[model samples]
Target: MSGNDIDVYLEPLVDELKQLWDGVETYDANKGTTFKMRAALIWTISDFPRLKNLSGWNTYSGLACPTSKRRCIGEDADQDDSYWKKRSVFFELPYWKDHMLRHNLDVMHIEQNICDNVVFTILNDSVKSKDNLKASKDLQSMGIRPELWPDEGGKYPSAIFTMSNPQKNVFLKTLQNVVFPDGYSSNITRCVDIRKRKLYGLKSHDCHILMEQLLPILVKNALPSPVSTVIANLSSFFRELCGKAVNPMQLGGLSNHVMQILSRVNDQPVDVTNNIGKTMFPEIGKASRAVSHFGLTLMERDQAHRHVLVNCEAVVPFIDTFRTETKRKLWHQTRSPSKIDRVVHAEFSRWFKRKVPMDSTLHSKEMKLLACGPMQARCFRAYNINGYKFRTITKEDGLKTQNSGVYVSSNTSYASMRDNRVAVGSVPYYGNIVDIIELNYSCHFTVVLFKCIWVDTTTSRGIKQYHLDLTSVNFTRPTHTGDREEDEPYILASKAHLVYYVRGEVDQEWSVAVHVKPRDLYDMGGENEKVEAAAFSPQPGLNMSAAGDISDLQLTREDDIEDPIEDVSDNIDDVA
Candidate 1:
């Protein structure tokens, strides 16, 4: 097909393939066949550039309908609605069928060969130039000596040395026996080299062997097993290898051997509840040569003690007295209170005094009292008794009264009353008190208490809001100086009201006036104004009052005998 003809066919195919890919689970096993079909489609579209267009015979036009079996299709007919529709339908059927077949094939191929392919790829990459260089450098840093020989180009050899504190001769003997068993021979160099390259060919296995050999040594020191049992186990293991020369071959074989011994040791009946009594190792026939040196020193001390005689006749009483005094001193020290105990007690006393004061006057009253103080004004909203909506205020509506009744107490007298109550909307009343005192100045601050009560008038069943107590209410005062204070000194031009409603039933509410104490008003500005006026004013003269009264009399007479006032008079001059 010509390039344009091919392009027309492939563009739709590409778009359909992309849509199919998005609609289906792309990674599903069944979708593998679709990928193969997609690949085939791509290959076919790529070959579009190779097809030649025949001009005179109209091969392209013939090829447009493939029934003609021509090499190229005409672009004009390919763009035709009916022709393209037929072409699309023809292509879609095979595309879907091939996609399904190839997807299944891909699933099987992935299942059978993907894991091996991943493994080969990893291994191949690991052996690449950079990786090899890194491996060589790591081996060199680990002190692996390089060996060059005529037969072998080069190889790195491993080094082995005694890990623990070793006696030179004993270590030398052990090394010699390990490498040159049955006397020296031609293979001595190779054997020595192999021994030196302790962690060469079987590096992973060599590490495991070393770990196993060190297990018994670590267990002897670290096991929570009884001391006697641990000692006995070590003794038994050493006894088993007493006569046999220790060598690398034997060392490598120790992991299985020691494990076998440990398994048998564990199998021997043990009392789970009384493990301390259980003997880990039975008595061995021979002793370990390494332990014999220490054992001899202990034996010599015992023998020397057996020869010594006790001479406690004269000094016995003095020694006894000294021991008694020392015991008494220790006992007294243990019984005495520590410095930390005293410090804790002092801190507790201070904290108790600060948090719970000794002066009862500083304490708050049992019942919280909400009040309208000097600088505090009350704003209230009223609700209809039967309806959910708040009562609307009108110009003709008369003032209403709501009383909270009397609260009688022995320590304090508290009651609430309200008058001239206007019906405001359910929204929060936004108004400010003129002055508020800082917390430091106020002896006791007033809190605006709110309680929500749900009353069902029909059934006369009311539910007080849950945990709706005065203590839980969070009250915050203004932080800045510019804004007016909510609690301040002010004359109540009208009665103050306690505005509240049922929880979530703000639409139904009422207000009652509660008189507040003078102390509750936080009037910081009132105190400030008095201080500023005192500082700026002139000092008063006591004698000046009499003179001021005489002046006042003269002015009164001038006002009483009013005549036609002159343009400029002596009385006016005197007033000025």
Candidate 2:
């Protein structure tokens, strides 16, 4: 409540306090039973006829006996009865009456209001006519075409839209190279076509940034000389108004009303409150002002941090988060995202059928099944390592195939002759498979297993070797022997992997599938780091000192150097 309304406003709070004070009076009569407001600022009390100003009233002695039992007189105030006994309820409230210092004049609030008032003065409809009139006169003086501007009394658009499209283009072209003063580089970023932007899109800070930081340089050439000078003066006024310290000389133009409002500030620098208006301008202390005055804490940083560190339970999927009940339509048919791989398969099938007819049969389901008959989908025992179950490893040629083994007891590396067997880490450990066993429990499905013996394929690895039965040979294609020496090696059992077949790569004949690992799918990626370390190792001739020395890389200017390619002359004799 600013003026006359102060009495009407304090009624509700006074009633609430009276009831609380009554309860206190019933309990403890000795204790002074009274209630009051915590924090408040009464402004422009002099304007209200019903109110009496508290500022003139002394802190201790001088008294302007207020409307309440509490006497809000000045300190060392003269006790003469000449002081006005106005019926003001502001001094009546013990809360506000007791604490006079808490009643303050907010400098930031006044500055922000002044800025908006200044902005509206230049932009409002009343002033726009005069601005357009002056612009027309200036344009005519410059010999610009009269057709660019509308006739007098026409509905006035903003100053930016007054020019024709070509004129606007010219203005924008020149705006590109507009330079700002030192320490003011923010305008450099806005050196684009701001012609299309509406004035309302700008915030209070944006307005200030344009006026103080950029417009001083921009208006020098872009606007007419008179308009430029006015803008410069306005920017200067704003700069002074929004400054940390107020200058009475800079504030002469402001009316007595504004000056009276400012008079509330009794000291050299006016003090403002923690209202939202003050925090927007940089000259005001922003959020720090609120914290200093009212102990207000902002949670913007806390909220952002909370969002970044959100738990899995708190995270909502994009589809779920923004789901709409309205049935939406699309140009193309929607497919299940979960079965996205199937779409790729269908697309390729259609492509093959249309683009290459003869290859269609080769790409058929029947043909693929014929080649990969034994490689049908089947789950195998996969040993878990590091909490990850890797189903396959890529074969040398990049195909997916199971890691099968044979008993190469003598031929395998790290084999003991006494045991006549190799450990699991050996490549030939699974080389021997003498028998096949099928077992089924009463309540279970068929379980197939290999009953095996050791093998000795010494020719493959310079160890020992032994051949297998015809049945066993077909069952396990142990190609690491005899004339098939160039065949793919038996993948080491140390890198034990389960595998799958490539459907598209299959042929008419039974194709032994080559394994390809999806390296990215594994929790632990492929052993690329280990391979890279060995590849770039220092050569034998170079010592550590030679490699590390800066002097080793000496640059020499070779004046004697000739072009490696001889430039042959046009004449055949000279070319030779």
Return the top candidate by TM-score: 2
Q: What TM-score goes with each of the models?
A: 0.11, 0.23
Error of 1 at 297 (Å): 51
State how far residue 480 of model 2 sits from its true place (Å): 99
State the lDDT of candidate 2 residue by residue for 1-576, as single tens digits.
Answer: 354345566678766665554444243347656543233344432312222433343222222224222344433355444454334454444554455542344444444344444333343324423446565566657464354455676543455423344443444455456665777444533535346511233344555665564455554554556555655665665576667798686454443223223322211111111111222112211110111111111232121112121211111121121121011221144533322322321232232223223333212232222112112112223223222233222111253434333232222332222222333343533332222222221212222223232233322332222231111112223332212211122222222333322222442222222333433366465667453344343443333343477777759865758657664565668667
Residue-by-residue lDDT tens digits, candidate 1, 64-139: 3232222232334444343232232213433543432211122222222322222122222223212244444565
Go through the candidates in order and give the clash count of each.
13, 38
lDDT of 1 at 247: 66
Best by lDDT: 2
TM-score of 2: 0.23
lDDT values of the candidates? Answer: 0.27, 0.35
